[model samples]
Target chain A: MGLLVVFGQIYDPAINAAALAFDRALRADLPDGVIETVPTFRSVLVRFDPLEISCPRLEGHLQELLARQDWLQAEPDDAAQHWVLPCVYGGARGPDLGKVADLMGRREDQVVAAHAAVELRVAMLGFSPGLAYLGQLPEAWNLARRSTLTPEVPAGSVLVAVRQTVLPATPIPTGWHAIGQTPFRAFVPAHRRPFLLAPGDRLRFEPVAEPCYAAFDQADFLRKSGG
Target chain B: MSGLEILSIAANATIQDAGRPGFLRYGLSAGGAVDPYALAEGQALLGNAPDDAALEFAGAGGRFLARSDVWLATSGAEMTLTVNGDARPWRQSFGLRAGDELRLGPPQTGVYAYLHVAGGFQTEQVLGSRSTHLRAGLGTVPRPGIVLPFRADLPHSQQPLKLPRPGSFSRRCFRVLPAPQADLFSAETRQRFLAQEFRIGQMRDRMGMRLEVEGSAAFQAETGLSIASDATNLGDVQITGDGTPVVLLVERGSAGGYPRLVTVISADLAALAQVPSGELIRFQEISRDDAVVELRKYRREINTLKDLVQPVFRDPHQISGLSGMNLIGGVIRGDEEDNHDDD
Candidate 1:
């Protein structure tokens, strides 16, 4: 059995640049049998088939690849599908908006502006199937996750937590602040590729009035076709 | 016509064959018999194929009235078996006449027991298996009035049942292979895992078993990694953010994000499946080669046992003499005093 060696520190939260660089380097050197590699703010998970390659072998391969440092650090790929998600930001649609604005010491409109201003990147899709974690929320809107989790949140609920935005793909429990609700469904099981959003995709939240929200809701545009 | 009619069906009675394997890539777990060894043993006793379907009774067993004469065998933890109020020996095949009542009591020792008919239970194969996936709602349970079909052509012989050597089913040590993320823990934490005996927590089922590791050590870093949700198989021990160890089982989700610490070997997985709550469990790390060797030994033993029972059909003369003596021991005799306790 060959050795599969993994390089880099176990997990470090501060340096996203180092994590991204290491991900690219590992991909360039070891492409075969690398089913998928998911990079987070701190660490990376490289998965492979155990039958095809033993853990020791994979570990050794990683160690050698890291030592050589032959791979170049490429820029983040900009080729991503952009999606404009329509959302109702206040009232029943956004129950936590006032609370979040109070926590941030900003008005409701300013909180909405901060949320919609930045172009969020889909860092990863995990925690549940099709749940995409979008990151780099505006500095003013950065907030910690709720102290306790809500029993259950409906699917398509748009939440914000720790400088990131999450478009839930399923009916899952969460501790994040549900700042708004989206009429655009991000995941549809019936589609050829169920998740409309991918790890590298970009999202822009477009605010809508209550009347427009009602129209979108009545039209059922959020529900996937044939869903 | 040959069939077995249900007199009383237990709460969790369901048909199971050798589980559906090699489907993890498609987001499906291999769901099958809770106790594969007992299921295979029941088939071997009746000279049936290893993959034949059988009724897996959980916690409590059921009652059945034989509609026609048929050969059947029962195996797993010493459960009481009765034929028309008379006790019948277990782990052995015997003939049941029409209108004969067969009753099974609660397990005296183990968690699951298997009942195998000479002709395998007839059920539609779904996704390449006759196994019932309760979570997926794929197969219907045996109802009280349901009639199950059997093969009429099966040759009947009154051979002495071969009983397995009795072994204690109490607390036992399990062997495991170190997981991919095993190195993530400090050397002391790893040592603690080997030295400390953890109790099986209350949260356990077909999906996973939660182990209570008292006085938890700082196992993994506070900062976590976002691992891509990939295939998670049986015996894979995953550690959550809170440092609790959860061993995934037969019906576990196809993928997960938690860091895995170890994967128990295939040979020891059966032992892990039957471990009840509050039972003490400890892990012993073994090499992958050793694990494969142990698995081979178990398979060889079963194959040898199957061959031992195959010759009775060809030599009918040997069984005919023993049939007259009534091989069924522990049967209640004609004592009116003994019948009073039953009421």
Candidate 2:
């Protein structure tokens, strides 16, 4: 097949929903010879080998596909629609929860309530392999990213910055504020599809009690389908 | 079987062919010989195919002991090649006896060198290639006392060794084509890039080489634009956030975030590969058509070289001098009377 391009808009409570929507639209229409499409907060990067397809031809095909937007009407099947991610907020699991609450001038409970208030869409998987950038956080919980980046944040960290939540798939340096930790590993390299979360899928992080952390191991939960 | 046993191998040495391509999507770089031209030339000296995997030595070449009688050749930036404490010729094949020690000293001309055995270095191929990805640490270096295996039957050679034309090894001006994001830079900055001379920074490797541009004006107007990271290839001159231009090499990152000002032509990548650190480099802009013409010329030269070494066959039925024979009077002269002739 040649190139297939589709256009659409996606909505999340926090951050810019339009950008995520564009990425989902791009993935749905990728043609043959495309290894993988890289999505960001603003645009999608469609990569192809020049030997298989020329740059000018690919660019021209993309322009035509983008012009047609019929694929947006097709709803995501029930199996691909949404995912419920279990999270533990505050305490050692979320070291920056208190700091985030302080910055927003809100109580810890209020911050937790606001985070679970709306369904977030997986905007993109970037900054690192399999790291899902989920958005948009409620305006009340919206905050700027830290001025200085943390040297190495652990994997499965539920980070909040610029009014969005990011679940890092691997240990990486980030400027986001750590508000919580998730027992569910969104990314597992050994799995056939390493990343469970894909752009356009809905994500809702449910807060759990601190005592519940002992009942499950983060690594084991990642091994199984649902935490 | 004839083979070369490792005596003193350095880090990053591995068997490399003509890079594993078509796997960029799998997050794997086409890991191949850093100096493919030299590798090909070394193989050509043994009358072997260009795709044969040869030992690629990085940083410092290693010491090896010939385990059996075999032919070997070395090519790349001039490294001190010696056999049994006596120097052997570079880019030409020579017979080596058992127990002979072959040593390659630090690179004096280029960073990487290719060592090819008559029957290529036999190594386990992964993903259809023996090329090593050092950053990923997939392959192990040749350890001291390691015995390398090879096939006993060597390909029969019919022609004498034909040397490749000596190429310029020193650093010099490189021809560049405008990159996809060349227009992102200001006109003044672009002009400054063309006018200025850049020094190869010490932070150079197979992945990339940082070029230290002398004046700050090289990035004056294009200071703070945040460009999205994208895949880059060799010769891509990316401007880092700090304003220095880093010329990407063979094993460059699958993608990058810096703005690329220009891309060096594929034909000139070999020349740029030989450029040593601290060497002065200047960029000369050329049209895309001109770049293609240069690449075509290189391809033609290779084809011509290949034709020169092709084996020739003889036809026994077609006898020479048949047309030159003339009937000497009524009776044929010389031996014509004894042989069968038209009555």
B266-304: candidate 2 lDDT, tens digit per residue: 778777877888888888999755776776676565545
How much TM-score does chain B earn in each model?
A: 0.82, 0.83
**What would the TM-score be for candidate 1 when compared with the true structure?**
0.62
lDDT of 2 by residue, A171-197 (tens): 768788988887766655445554567
lDDT of 1 at B259: 68
lDDT of 1 by residue, B1-343 (tens): 4778887888777888886664343334567886677777788888788888888876678889888777788876657899888786677767676777899898776667788888788776666677776654445468798877777787433353555633525636888887766776666777777777888887876677898877666356334555533346468888877788888877776557676777887667766766667778898989876765776776676677776552122233543553354432212222322322322
**lDDT of each structure?**
0.67, 0.66
- Whole-model lDDT, model 1: 0.67
> Highest DockQ among the candidates is held by which one?
2
Tell me the tens digit of each residue's lDDT in model 1 across A1-74: 11223223322223333445566667777746555555544445565544456656777777675666532243
Q: What DockQ results for candidate 1?
A: 0.08
